[model samples]
Target chain A: MMVSNDDAALVVERIGPQALVEDSGRFGVRHLGVTQGGALDWVSLGWANWLLGNAPGTAGVEIAIGGFALKAEASMTLAIAGGDLGATLDGAPLPPNGAFAIERGQTLAFAQPVAGLRAYLALPGGVVAAPFMGSVATVAREQLGGLDGRGSALAGGDRLLAAGTCAAPREMPMAPALPREDVALELVTGAQIGHFEGASLFATFNSPWQVDTRADRMGVRLTGPELRCQLGGMISEGIPLGAVQVPPDGQPIILLNDRQTIGGYPRLGALSPLACAALAQCAPGTTLTLSPITPHQARRRYLATLAQWR
Target chain B: MSDAQIRVSEAPVIRLETVGMDALMVRLFDAIDEAHMPWILAADRALREGFGEDLVDLVPSYTTLLVNYDVERLDQREASACIRDALIGLRPASTAAGREHRIPVWYDESVGPELPRIAERLGVSCEEIIRRHSERDYCAFALGFTPGYAFMGMIEEALATPRLKTPRQKVAAGSVGIAERQTAIYSMRSPGGWNLLGRTAVKLFDRERDDISLFRPGDRIRFEPITRDVFIEQGGDTTPLEERG
Candidate 1:
């Protein structure tokens, strides 16, 4: 099977709670006080693009808790990955992490999530849009970079286009190892790690943290143990992705891609990127535990994961 | 870049610590002051000159410069060591240049949601409150909490107030506010607790503008008090500013 240059177009029939155009991430502009707006699950975006023989960092659509439907305006090969969003093409099942062609009248619909919270849809030449700040990653809060270059979620009647062209279909040599059933997130102990009292530390590691309903692309609020950090009022500081910050209320907020550029809260540390990807896939009420990994260990794991893309 | 006065031995020793696996923070002070800006700016320059591509992004806030790096090229230990050494060699900011933007603000009882209450609490008149607030020329220290939301300040000590007892459910974008030493514009309609001073006619952030960010670090801001008529004359969309063109 191969992709075609038949002006492949996707028309949004029904949009989910959220659907966005995303690349790997917007880099080198964090100093401009811009947040890195990209795929919450970078791993899945890579795999979707890879299935279409596109570069790993190419743009794709990120559908959250799918209730989305798209009608193909022109026949083209596309790929999907991430959480099983219970997708079906013309009522037939479309499995994840595989590429297939769709006819002009075919309708691809995704119901509620089966396992994962997000699904990525990728095309041969990737979705084409003018770049803002050198990226097309949709940041709803920032209102920058989307199909319209205005950062709005996929709306009904919107037409999606790719640099549609023919390319040889490629299959994954082997699928990456899926995350374990018991979700154990890994965080590297850093800034203000010593500031937390031993009791809080004990609770942090031992207790199961529940993902609060207040979770979003900005960050996930973990509610369970009130972690006390022994520090005076903090001056605002740069916040990295997955930084586990404890505010005055003692609840921890694990910041993500759409998080603000800086914050003034004491932090326990930042979670590994892989752990963040896992956390992104989690729905509200999901209980997970934080496992401390050395920075060295995190580097090895992150690089090893990136190695699979090429 | 060359015209800086940084000395290795005389400068205060900067602490290099970890914010996360991918980021190394070079902290200069616990809190921020005008004195710290030069040091922070200098350190930022030194790091950019020193590490180059290994440095992914450097986010400078009031007290710390958070450096995100490629873990493959520079691990945590090396990044910290490199930052620690670079801090010693950081050059002092030499006549750092920044733009001066005079924003038009309508300071009226009706214009400011919390002005009357803040005036009563401070035992001052609403006019007096506006006078002290618009008098000082505050610098943009950092942007965070939200996109295009600039944390610019060093407000007059007498006018400084703590965050609202309970933050407002929503603060309109372009609303000017003060909380403690910091004064800022609520660029987006986000929940904020700052004492609302007034609203500005000019949107602080507009994606349609040539420069997406109106306020940058080191930039000076002065509020030009305008009449209500002038505020309306300029597209007075008092609703929250959406991040759009």
Candidate 2:
């Protein structure tokens, strides 16, 4: 459905770096070579939607590294969660992790990050955009999804709309912990994990790895130990989200939502979904340690986390 | 052989590997094989129906299928059971499974910068390289790297070329290229490392189409050589792509 200007809630004044519309993600289409594009920090996105009482996977604006400003087109209520990107209402600081009321012509601006790398802003209903392949999540590289239905990032002059009017506002007492200097990520060991040398395996979990600047929605390159794999190049196979692929150079890249469908490099294992959410919040140069967990343990933890939402 | 006899033959042993908490890597074969396509497609179809609402996404590649499931609905054990049951008594689909496509290509030095280099490396003329590449009907093994980008493969060994040492910063849409034994069309312009040989006007991926992607996993594909004029007439871009520093 087309969102007419009558219901337009906000208008983009400026965009710094990048911002995009995201939801749970695009699925059931991997065979078409389409990557699952969505909010990198999914936990926060859920909380943002929760604050507004929308479905957990409802669409929201993922503002990355701040410097985005929007002018309220109409009086409305919205929720902000995830990173503390120093959001403000007409120059007054608006705290993250709760719903707030804004008047017409009031400005909601996001400055440089004060905590995490990305913040999710959810509307009362949800950001209304034409869903491409069943999602409005933008994968810029693939040119799919977003306001224009071509994966374009939020830019000046773009109009934003919410599907429905607001209900009673809600708030969360706390938000997910912001990334720290030494964040420990939970990883589930599998797929070619035994092929790595004992020493490399030990280093993978025991040492500190720094997030490299080559980070994006696709994947994050962790620099630290030169992990050596005993196995040679194998046939290119399907890669799952969070698969830690170690290339010939030894730097391990943790593939994420927007990663390619297949890869040939050897992999140590994959990070748990929660771990991926945490890692997405870490700024480049943040130190990280890998904590091994079993698939059963990971599943239990995933269920427990989801249970908290309801 | 009869259908019953084919089913009686030893089925390839498949293994399942845990991918994080919610997904499993269903490994069909340890190596790449042309025969693996039918089995992969069959498994993909079965799992899509079997998992129903529980399945999040299933990614099929050359030798493995990564099944992403909803952990809220099924645990690891239950998901595995569903997978095994769906794959029970699995048989490869017949040779004639998916749609066949005839893609017309315009092969020229102006559009394919790597054409002369590839011919020189193979010690053959450009026309010979094009002839060898167009002669075989390739199987669409997978779709990836980008939307509508189908990785069709096993080009003539004589025509096979290694990927560029350094990927071109920009590869125009419809640029046909080969990397090792694999050949694919650049469905959308992006940075690519493949060796370009020609260009196609066909839109492999069109959002307006009922099926956004032109090629499915098991589709058969053949390349028909076309004149530059025909390529231009068919809406193919002939503007030379320069190698950016």
Judging by DockQ against the true structure, name the best candidate: 2
Per TM-score, the best of the predicted structures is 2
Q: After superposition, how far is residue A258 of candidate 2 from its true place, in Å?
A: 1.4
- Weakest lDDT window of 10 consecutive positions for candidate 1 chain B: B1-10
- Writing each residue's lDDT as its tens digit, candidate 1 over B113-165 gives 66777789889898888888888677778877776777887888877778877
Query: How well does model 2 score by local distance difference test?
Result: 0.87
Q: Chain A: TM-score in each candidate? A: 0.95, 0.97
Per-candidate clash tally:
1, 0
Using Cα atoms, each model's DockQ against the true complex is 0.63, 0.77
Given candidate 1, what's the lDDT at residue B138? Answer: 75
Which pairs in model 1 have colliding backbones?
B6-B92
Q: Model 2: how far is A140 from its true place, Å?
A: 0.9
TM-score of chain A of 2: 0.97
Can you tell me which runs of candidate 2 are displaced by over 4 Å? A1-7, B1-10
